[model samples]
Target: MLRVENLVRRFGGITATDNLSLDVARGELHAIIGPNGAGKTTLISQLTGQLLPNSGAIRFAGREITTMPSYKRSALGLARSFQITSLLTDFTALDNVALAVQAHDGHSFYFWGSARNEKHLREAARSALARVGLGHRADVVVSELSHGEQRELELAVALATKPQLLLLDEPMAGLGITESARMVKLLQELRQEVTIVLVEHDMDAVFALADRITVLVYGRVIASGAPSAIRQNEEVRRAYLGDQHAVTDHA
Candidate 1:
């Protein structure tokens, strides 16, 4: 469903995405794993149009979107959640999700007042929140929710767009063990419904949820295959997995 070819992005003298090429099939959950400064986020930024690539191409569902703006990409069925929580601190969870729905429908900013009262928007937001296990906390202010809950809310907002591909950057970054497990479970269920490109530090989650794993090092692909193949790859182990081997041993 998604294809990238020879994508390169640079910052001054540093190469952040060095000729990275990858493919994500329809309905597949592809995980991107790498150590810090490995350029995973840079690749994602280029794919999502947050940062235009210095060169190369990105195509989704058969059309090139390399130069599409972020909002246009979102409109074209691509959505992403940041590594850090991005939410309106003062807004209730439902309100935040409702805004996402409004944006997806291309409603003007001036329509928000009436949009909030629209039953369809509220219902859609509520359904998205419920999908992310936040239905009961809809009225809670984002600032009042726990970090894990906030993270889930982020997913809800992304889902409110009804994206065909979901790009999640470290959804488990700051969660507790139980919360991480919950996110994993939610993702496991979600993979059945949509294509996902997960960039995460949690090996357990990557091994548990990814249909295929792609390891990146210094903006280039080091390995790409099924989870088992990635776990067994010597280059992957040495370059990223290190000596833990938990990707194979535990999962």
Candidate 2:
């Protein structure tokens, strides 16, 4: 569903994304794994239009979107959840999701005084919340939710847009063991609904959920294949996996 070809993005002398390229097939959970400074996040930023590439091409669902604005990319069925939580702290979880729904529907934020009063918006928001297991906490303010709950809420916010491709940047960033397990389960279920591109530091979760793994080093793909193959890749191990990551049943 997504294709990146020889993409390059440089911050002066530092090339964050150096001729990076990859493809994500429809309905697959493609995981991007690498050590720190490997440019995974930079690549995602380019995909979402938060940063423009110095050169190369990006295509989504067959169309060129390398230069499309972030909002335009979102409108074309692409949604992203940040590495850090992005939410309206003072608002209710339902309100935050409803706002996402409102925005995706092309309803100007100023059109209605609030998204809460709109029945359609509320219903959509509720559905998104339920998908991410946040329905019961819909009325709770974002600031009051637990860290895991906040992460779940962020997923709900993205899902509220009805995206076809979900770009997740380290969804398990700060979660504990149990919370990380829950997120792995959630992503397992979600992958059935939408194509996902996951950038995660949690090797366990990555091995558990990724249909295919792509390993990056110095902003370039060193290895890209099935989980089983990736685990045995010497180059991948030398570059990033090191001696820490253990073999999972996936191999």
For all candidates, what are the clash counts?
0, 0
For each candidate in turn, the TM-score is: 0.97, 0.97
Q: What is the lDDT of residue 183 in candidate 1?
A: 94
In candidate 2, which residue pairs get closer than 3 Å at backbone N, Cα or C atoms, i.e. clash? none
- Report how far residue 239 has shifted in candidate 2, in Å: 1.1
Q: What digit string (tens of lDDT, one per residue) describes model 1 on residues 1-251?
A: 99999999999999999989999999999999999999999988898998999999999999999998999999999999998898999989999999999999988778546657989989999999999999999999999999999999999999999999999999999999999999999999999998999999998898889989999999989889998888889998888887676355455
| Candidate 2, RMSD to the unseen true structure | 1.3
**In candidate 1, which residue pairs get closer than 3 Å at backbone N, Cα or C atoms, i.e. clash?**
none
Q: Ten residues in a row with the worst lDDT in model 1?
A: 242-251
Candidate 1: list runs displaced more than 4 Å. 246-251
lDDT (Cα, 0-100) at 31 in candidate 1: 98
Q: What lDDT score goes with residue 89 in model 1? A: 91
